[model samples]
Target: MNDARDVTILGEPERSDRPARPGREGKGEIHLVHMYPREMSIYGDLGNTRCLAARIRRHGYAPVVHQHHPGDELPEQVHLLVGGGGQDSGQVTVEEDLARVGDRLRSLADDGVAMLMICGMYQLLGQTFTTVGGRQLPGLGLFDVTTLGGEERMIGPIVLSTDFGDVVGYENHSGATTRGAGQAPFGTVRHGRGNDGSDGTEGAITGHAIGSYLHGPILPANPAVADALIGWAAEASTGREFEPEPLDDEVARQARTRQIARLLG
Candidate 1:
């Protein structure tokens, strides 16, 4: 795993795509657009998209992820867009590029487009996040939250409850978040809520859009999460229902168990 990109290869990205009409091949393809440079591959972020593609294929669907570099053309069709964590410095390095996609991103999320962003990516999707500079910088304003100053970051095993069930992932972010009034918290903190007793930060989300601090390449550890995303897209984009099947093969099961255990530990 390179520091610039960590991919745990649970599966590969598929070539085919969903039908535009009910069962038409290549009729509709769920696209995942990844912004930022290689996400700095912090703690298995690439695994999220890899797991997404794999889970979609396992459920009889195809996914194409467009890894967008600055000046790269955006895909014409996007069913779900994902952004993951990176260092604060890394994100700041590409702030202008990120802002360039602001209108497109806001439109997608506002139109009920399915999305999942974690940590650094989550911070980018907000209205503003405070930095150590004691000044607030403008964010994409996709969500009603602000990142606050914090010297400590939450890392290691994290537990949270979702409609799916008790979910698990890791946290590693110094930018604490605060949701606006009437804003929905993405995921709740089951363990450590803040670096100290002061400004306790938490998760936030709106509609099909989800932004969380959970790391550990979130999707691989929680297949339900990946499937939830795929199912949402399939239902929304193609009207075909998707159901995520748990790994049944001994080999696959063992591998999954080992990985999830590692994350949990």
Candidate 2:
């Protein structure tokens, strides 16, 4: 679907209704699984999936978008996974289901599946998330990090220096996440509060799996990051080098440039 509002809490899986635009065909199918779209996608995060699907089409791949919710079985062949942020109550609601599939998720990470977990999902993919009320939520331990809810909310546009160049997004979270020693970070904070207010690190990266707090819906403005994930998924799925055909990203570039200027200057 083009809009996140189109996502509904249904018993079965829902595929994207967006028709495939004309592009080179026969590249292959990329299975994208979106986790907890209804309960955990409050922050316009579903846009990430839409962006990926659109980009996949541009690169000559047919995107098979799958919406995975609580109590639902995961797609057997997942090439890429994307999840969004949610509130504490929403986290609590999906905690059990996440735990049930935690092993599978972890295994996917270990198997080099390309995945992105943002905000609340990012926290839950870590070692633990202790709420301000002292309720500790167990995580999948995919990232060697721990999160604790805090009183102050860190909300702003954030810029990060990464291998993908300067990635830009918005951060709206109060969870202070501390990465374990020796754990690699996704990027370094250039403008906003990162994992914790004090840490220079932004997000955690393990293999091809990434967990971050940035949510400008993230992907639309950062084509490099999106392409990186797509490349990884494509390579892992086909066991071949995946070089994506370039597309016109002038609008995204202009948006990113302006946002960076406004936030940095």
Candidate 3:
């Protein structure tokens, strides 16, 4: 119920003293908004925001992170949006508040603002989510998909063949989502369950908005996908192409490789 703005420059605790890296002097700020952080950040999903903020800084841009809660106004300018998963009770808690700002979120997506919605947030961005008890929750309809809660919870490591490359993460959900004909999947599932246990599709994507169930916080090991989101946001904010400096991702690469191998083998 506390709607105060919690702003932070992720990674730089002492903003006044740290000297800017060479070539990073002129780059401005990229506003990253985290929606319902208090209610929807279960399963370490807050890591996604931290990952983006750190990477944004490493890419020579300052990440201005805004944590949005119920009754709070969204920042006037949002370069990127990140929302995480939560329990059914948590979903119910934010259901009304989510609807209140659904229009703004949909508008942002239509205008190509980059967004990443994970698990419960992903489900709520679709047309509808029917819980196991037959209760229905209305979504923002950003993704042309529908979800039905099932008895079986899909939980495990997952690998997806995506446009960005191989994306690895963990999926834990009971919602079985089915995409409409107009919806394009974020990736093809290569291992474990995705939106549904049977669909072979991992997630849904339209324009710059993406909805996925993969959570191992989903960004640390899949830097490619994270960078893609950052790139889209940067371009949309600046109205120009974004060329980020290459950061060493060897550790992430190795981590991804090991996860994939462990899952596939």
| Local distance difference test, each candidate | 0.66, 0.87, 0.87
The residue pairs that clash in candidate 2, if any, are: none
**How many collisions per candidate?**
8, 0, 0
RMSD of each: 6.5, 3.6, 4.8
Model 3 vs truth, CA RMSD: 4.8
Error of 3 at 118 (Å): 0.1
Ranking by lDDT: 2, 3, 1
lDDT of 1 by residue, 171-212 (tens): 777776777888776555555452222334356778888888
184 in model 2: Cα distance from truth in Å? 1.2
- After TM-score superposition, what is the CA distance of residue 122 in candidate 1 from its true location, in Å? 0.3
Q: Residue-wise lDDT of candidate 2 within 178-253, one digit each (tens)?
A: 9999789999999999999897999999999989999989999999999999999888777888868878889899
Query: Residue by residue across 183-239, what tens digits does model 3's lDDT show?
Result: 999999999888888979988999999999999989989998999999998897778
What stretches of model 1 exceed 4 Å from their correct place?
Answer: 1-28, 37-40, 194-201, 243-265
